[model samples]
Target: MAATGGSGRSTVADLLAAGMAADGASAVVLDTAPRLTSPWPSWTVGQEAEGLAALPPDRPLTRSHVRHAAALRPGADRPDWHVLTDGRDWHSPPLTLPQAPAAWLQLAAIGGWQCVVADTPHPVTHDLLQSRCAGHIGLTRSWCELPYAVPVLCASATAGGVQALQQAVMALHAEGMPLQRTVAVLVAQTDGRLPAVARAGATMLSARIAAVVHIPHDPHIRAHGLRTVTRLRSRTRHAAGLLFHEVLAAAGASWGTPLPDAPRPAPLAVVSHS
Candidate 1:
């Protein structure tokens, strides 16, 4: 009965929801800005400025606004603030993670009390997965996942491409992105690019990350991808649960908590994502 935190849009939320469902718990998703912000189509310059003004002072918000606001700097095209609040004259300061109900919900949902929390701030969709380890709850020592945040330079691929991917990951890491956030990378298999990514990732992120999966490229395989997507999604989720259990076991070894090996859950359907 412990809680953990994660940061993201749909990806983290989706995975968290799946985890909550699997564990029969609840998930409270927090947005970076007020929920009443403008829709995607209305995300123009003036529109965003207006949207910022329209943000609610106390409601949860998404990080999109902050990222966008930062983008509007001298050489930027937009701003990047999760939620914009009124200045000196406003009723409240601004919305932030601490103000969001998700934190409390996670605490209540897990053990009926506060326990653990995780977050990552990368803009392209990525987060730290380490903070979710089950055994670290209420522990005095916190495990850092720095290597997982580093890029394992691949020789087969263009330095620029690998660098870009690495930059994206680093951005997420520096931004305090959640650990469970999944990153998508395009690799040239014949060139050993996948291995490079894995090797580098393993070397740099071994302590924080669990495993690196290589998904084959198959164009025709996507014909019925939605179903497969659903299945693979389930598989990854179960894998996460397994990871949680492993953490618990490790923690038990030192804390005398007497962790038990939970029964393996049924395999999820595998779908082709070409």
Candidate 2:
């Protein structure tokens, strides 16, 4: 989640989901932003395909239904990491799509996505407030409460951006959100230049969040807008790896009850060195 755009929100979402898929997990990136502006279909084959909006939110969505609706990754099979977003054009008729967090959870549950990375829309602080008041559970809160969900907060690497990000983080903390498991990513829009305020902000934020990682601006991503992640600079990939590791460390715990027994060392050989 991010306070605003240009925060690398979509980039972060794509990286996490794609990385998980490459690691053999069933991952899906859910686009919650407006259809017209969403980047999910930017370079994939989903530009003109039926997407999340086409699925019948009122009825159960099967794997086949989801696969048919999604925009598959490049060189990926049906079951590989897919992106679910809008497929409408300017002339297309209006469509009804689910926006509530619960609705998305249901979709993910039915689709059986082992990992869901959502690229949310603007004004996340407002969303956090809306979901907390008057007995409402907004998308932000619901996703935060997902079992073992590690939230990745993004902000541009700038003074103004970091200040705004700090405010958003404060709001989330006031809402009792999990800062311990959350990771903050400072996305450098310019290469080899990070503002002093952003650096200081990261230092302060490090005390409150799980980890703070910096993503160097990749000229390729800037030019292509996540058209393909394979061409990312090695440094960018390394930073993404750090973000992934921090999230995994935060999730290091049993899934639930009936937990499998912890591995015990085999009894030492009883031959007594015989």
Candidate 3:
């Protein structure tokens, strides 16, 4: 997962891992971000940070080493779900961006994990997009970040968002990113129905990407903080599931089964707000 800061990349990564694990797949999350917090709440109290810090800087990382360092998620139905994150000040010099991908690849090899969700740092570069991961999920709170699109999840939906999405999609295509792999996730931040502007924005975004998944805002996520998908609000969980399915399909993951097409929500007509 890649996105500009605060685009909810970590949350999405957590959800994706949970979804995979719930399906009986062995999944792991590698947090390459600078924070000390574990995106997956279940592993927060474990020795995850220490495990990552113990990785030998001089030797090639292996499955055995990773397993030794990874912290397993407690209470998971599947015993294989785990997480790894660097402890603050653990490495004399923290792992650089170039080094992070190699570490992620090494961890992916271990335990024959079915999915490896990497919560990468912000401003995802072209090289990261082309990295040897199963696929990429890009999150953006604004349309301007569309140029970095890779099965993108746009977190906002407004009139301005609609215009920005169009420009972003074109910019992404111009920059050599495949638009077919793009997606827009319009997040409503309140309990009421989606605003007309947001609904219209979703329609415009859908025209340019593989799918547009609307996530109804859930206060529970904010109140309780990040946790397993099973603990999230029903609406939020359903939306995340849809987003996960769309992303996997866009990435051409063999594990993804075909989902039947459902009628999209009616798009509220665009209107001037000013």
Strongest candidate by TM-score: 2
lDDT (Cα, 0-100) at 122 in candidate 2 = 55
Of the two candidates 1 and 2, the one with more favorable TM-score, higher being better, is 2
Q: Estimate each model's TM-score.
A: 0.32, 0.84, 0.69
For candidate 3, the per-residue lDDT at 111 reads: 37
Point out where model 2 deviates above 4 Å.
46-49, 75-80, 129-135, 253-274
Per-residue lDDT over 1-274 for candidate 2, one digit per residue giving the tens place of the 0 to 100 score: 9987778888887777756765667778888766667777565643555886679665545667877787866523213577888766645665666666666666666676666777777567878777677577777787787656778899999887898789889988999988888888899989886888888999999999888888888999999888776677878766755776667766663243333333222322334343
- The CA lDDT at 118 in model 2 is 73
Clash count, one per candidate: 45, 1, 0
Error of 1 at 60 (Å): 17
Candidate 3 structure quality by residue, lDDT tens digits, 180-229 = 77776665656888889878777766776778777676786666656543
Candidate 3 Cα errors over 4 Å, as ranges: 1-3, 36-43, 74-80, 88-103, 124-150, 157-167, 227-230, 253-274
- Deviation of model 1 at 122, angstroms: 6.2
The lDDT of each candidate is 0.30, 0.74, 0.56
Off by over 4 Å in 1: 1-9, 32-195, 207-234, 243-274
Best by lDDT: 2
lDDT of 1 by residue, 212-234 (tens): 23333223222432112233433
